[model samples]
Target: MTTDELIAPGTTGPATPTRRGSLRPLLLRLHFYLGVFVGPFIFVAAFSGLLYIFTPQLERAIYAHELTVPVGQAKQPLNDQVQAAQRALPDATMVRVRPGDADEATTQVIFSRSDLAPSHWLTAYVDPYTSQVRGTLETYGSSQAGPVRTWIDELHRGLHLGDFGRLYSELAASWLWVVVLGGLVLWWGRRRPAKGKGRRRLLSWHATTGTWVAIVLLFLSATGLTWSQYAGDTITDLRAALSWQTPTLPAASGHGGHGAHSEHAGPSGPAVAATADQVRNIARRAGLDGPIEIAVPSEPGAAHVVKQIRTEWPTKVDSAAIDATTGQVLATLRFDDYPLGAKLARWGIDAHMGVLFGLPNQIVLAAVCVAVLALIVWGYRMWWHRRPTKGGFGVGRPFPRGAWRSVPTPVLIGLIAVTAVLAWYLPVLGVSLIGFLLVDSAVGWAKGGPAVPARR
Candidate 1:
């Protein structure tokens, strides 16, 4: 993703005074190696992502009984809906409630008891107008993905393999930008026309498609890495350092973040119960409205944090903290108050997941996925086309060895410096690139030199 344009494709690189170094050869080699090694993971990500993108619709359809309801003459108090859910799941303890602001949608009363795992919650869907419990379903994650969508999510995220499977996604996210950027640079500098036939035609289509979709790919890669295991930690740290972390309501101690706030801790003593209706009223007065979630306070003095969850454009995600005992507004945070980095992170993630602009976002994401899939296939086909037909069993001609030799000294130094910085910033990419270079160097050493000396 770094460095200026290098030599164009198919010229004797760096042989003339006007020309610069043959960085394209090195890029080609890196791109080739990364493509050959990491492309499958990227392909799987795209393929599964294609399926995952449409899952919101799939989930809505699949859970229509629980997610939707008929319009009624008048809506009951929010407590009535919460009571219906509590009656349905008597053994469970209600944790939060997401009211169906729209007439057709059902209110969701989520519960997490002592016996239930932290990651899983039983949600009772109640018709807000009728105060009738529609059904209960187990949902996960902050978005509250249900069974079907969660399964699809797991398939895309980790192949249902837990922590180990996450590595595949992390690797894909880590390498995707480099591949996209490298391919784009190669396509741009090569200056191939879109008019030729056979392999040429395929090449033109591949380059054109890749160039067009590069923006989305780059965005996806960046956002995806922010969710990655290793890179996410680093990114979170960086965000904290930059003071761009998501803003939260003031903590009771005034020193903790949302998750660490004492207000969220277990009951400290005999506590007053705060009804969903009471919390909703308090939250509504604070300016949060439309599909808001009210986190049931654990204790009387606990602050019941109600957050607006609508992610689509005109996103209303402001939140307020209300004292459960006094029912007074403790604090509030507006979406408009979020730092630039925090806002970008929020929008980028939502857009990546096809939630930012709803249907239009999904369409764009699906198109990007299709483009990525096509590019991978076309790349392999081009590789196969370049194979020595007359020779026994070898793929494309490997770009000439020692392509880095043609790069000018200063440019090479700058490239190395940029690479080192990137490596540190992106650990996975850095480590893998260093490993690839080590392997390439070792092979060259075994073949008899520090680097295979190739002429331009």
Candidate 2:
């Protein structure tokens, strides 16, 4: 046995297949299991990605008046817009007013308070010059676009289960390792290559496809998992490195010296109100094109923040901070400003958004979604191919079968029943399974059932 005695081969003992290192096998198994277990979530991510790619464009097309204004009229003052929005929602706390672009006709205002029905609200389509409200938009529940975005965002994160969602996403990402491994297995298994040499051109195509996808897959999983868990930590570390902190800038330390002294300030959270006027001026000077959001800092020694949602394609929009009491710029960060871990997460998000490489990236990801759907079909095909042809139930081999057999049917049925009940009770698992079953049903119908042949 020591000398490979099991391979009783006079025909040159089956050329020893390349044995990889420990990390390789472990990574391979992890990928496989994660992909299998988190298939449903992955599908959701992929499908949503396909839809989200054109979100901006789609919104523009559908909500023209709300998003933009006609050119040539008198422009509205930001302060006036805030006043009008406040009058309409007197109970709400005024957040910020957004100035329109060249083509935008209406000024947008947002108001929020903890006591409000939805807790957060956005209102727009007000004529800035007249300070008259044209439309009232309520965000919450199934009735509003806000809810739609929130739900989609939740699906993108973890389908709404906070920690459970995070855990599931992380676990699913771990499975991507297996998908990569299985992909490699299928590739390598297809053609046995000679050692220390390149593969054939045709084989190379398949190999590289698997290789490229695996690389991106690893990037997506690692970054995504880290982001779901430690984005705050990652950002905090980056901020510390950049030395963004504040109690208040001494009157003597004014704007000119602000940048140099940024490091001396200790840990600052976010501030509640930095002057809106000063923030607008800072953002405009930096050439930011969109409306700015000033986040009120909740902690002591925090920076007042402004978020600019850029209309630019591909790159990240930025959030800049200014000291509320001091009127000094604290920090500015786009998605790119994140640390390695967070940057990885941002890249994954961009990739998931199908905007990482622009139009080509979107097409590639959509294709991947289609491929995933096909793999599911192919997996079932492989499973069926190995199944006994007699159509009788069989049992005891490890995997669960829909066609129960050998052991007591009642026992198996009961087990499935109880397990399903538990699964349904667990929201994340339940939602994921429902998602998969819907996809599965579509695939099954498309492929035709046991009695029907696939259509040409």
Candidate 3:
């Protein structure tokens, strides 16, 4: 759809007053407060995300000895690499093994312990060719991010403040689309002088930058919402109800249970009668190949899970559960057979994480982040310039009140209805929007309430 379709039309004429309109004034107020208040959280998320996207290369340089090895004539067995990792961390429960498919890349054997934070584990990097354990590091999340990326990721996800801190990001994500769409509508709905300085210039930059990156911002906001605490949980429940979640191979015995190893995401299953390499070979023969991970069963009766890890476009995430004892493939789930929603979710997530197109994906993500940052900067500049300065000192004056009074009865009702439904789907957005309105109203009341609309 075109940008015009994505945005509702607003008052169109010279930026100067042609008629008093409710929608544009209300949008201006909402947009202003969102940028002034929630903007910092968004700034942090964007800046950290920008840094996190490029950490794959940063990690390689910083941990070369652990991440890479001298090329050998041929690689050793996955079992050998797992053994080396086992020697290094005998006490930890084995989670999964990632056999670095690249010539000089090291095999990564991930282990989990009760002491580690949820979804955080120890990853022992081993030389596949030498069966030597290079080193171990605490990795985070499904992507197995190293220290540098993990630090930035933690900042982006929750500012390293844990669960409570996550609210900030969720709040930012929840409001981002409104900010984006509102900015688009406002920018497009009105006309500005061909040339101006100060507030006008800032407005031009902010609107143009926001419009240019509008799609990316919306995508980022939506995808990022899926990772939030409140909204994410709600969306997850909705997905499960619709069976839109990514399909998984059943455990060896067909029994299902999660949490055996948080990172693996495979159900509890029957005991394995074979090694990781054997199961991996089984999956390979079944047509799964290219950068795969083998999750060792944590609980007895759990089968080995071999799944493709490549997240690039045309995702190769086909997974299989193997009964190593019987050498039988218990179950298989192919990307092609995934439900439509699941497929889109996968692609959206991969693109959001900057792995869908490799380097180009990273570049685009970085550019979008810079654009967002610039918009925030320019927004504040506009707000600053718009502040009352009579006597050379005053606070910023918000858009005149009573703008909502000009809204048509049907349009206002429709807007409220749409917002309510969206709030149900995205609770954070609803909660924050209410909170802003109440606070703004209270402050205005305390200051003698909204001023009477001025006549042109």
Q: Give the winner by TM-score.
A: 3
Give stretches of model 1 more than 4 Å off. 1-20, 114-118, 191-195, 251-274, 442-456
Expressed as tens digits, the lDDT of each residue in 197-303 for candidate 3 is 55556666778888899999999999999999889988899899999987766563333223444443332232222377778789899899899888766666567
In model 2, the worst 10-residue window by lDDT is: 1-10
Please write out the lDDT profile of model 2 over residues 187-242, one tens digit for every residue: 55433442222223323443455555676566655555444454435444654676
Model 2, CA-based lDDT: 0.49
Please list the C-alpha lDDT of all candidates, in the order they appear.
Answer: 0.77, 0.49, 0.78
RMSD of 2: 13.5
Question: Candidate order by TM-score, highest to lowest?
Answer: 3, 1, 2
Listed per model in order, the count of residue pairs whose N, CA or C atoms clash below 3 Å is: 0, 15, 5
Tens-digit per-residue lDDT, 1-456, candidate 1: 111122222332332222235567677777878878898999999999999999989988989999999898888888777877877877776667888888899988877655544566788999988899988998877788899888888888888888789888988999999998988877777634545565567778888898999999999998999878888889999999999998777743242123422222332222112366787888888888778987765544567778899989987899888775588887888999999999999998899899999999999999999999998998788667666565477676555567687677888899999988888888878888888889877977897854344444
Q: What is the TM-score of each candidate against the true structure?
A: 0.88, 0.58, 0.90
TM-score of 2: 0.58
Q: Rank the candidates by lDDT, best first.
A: 3, 1, 2
Q: Of models 2 and 3, which has the larger lDDT?
A: 3
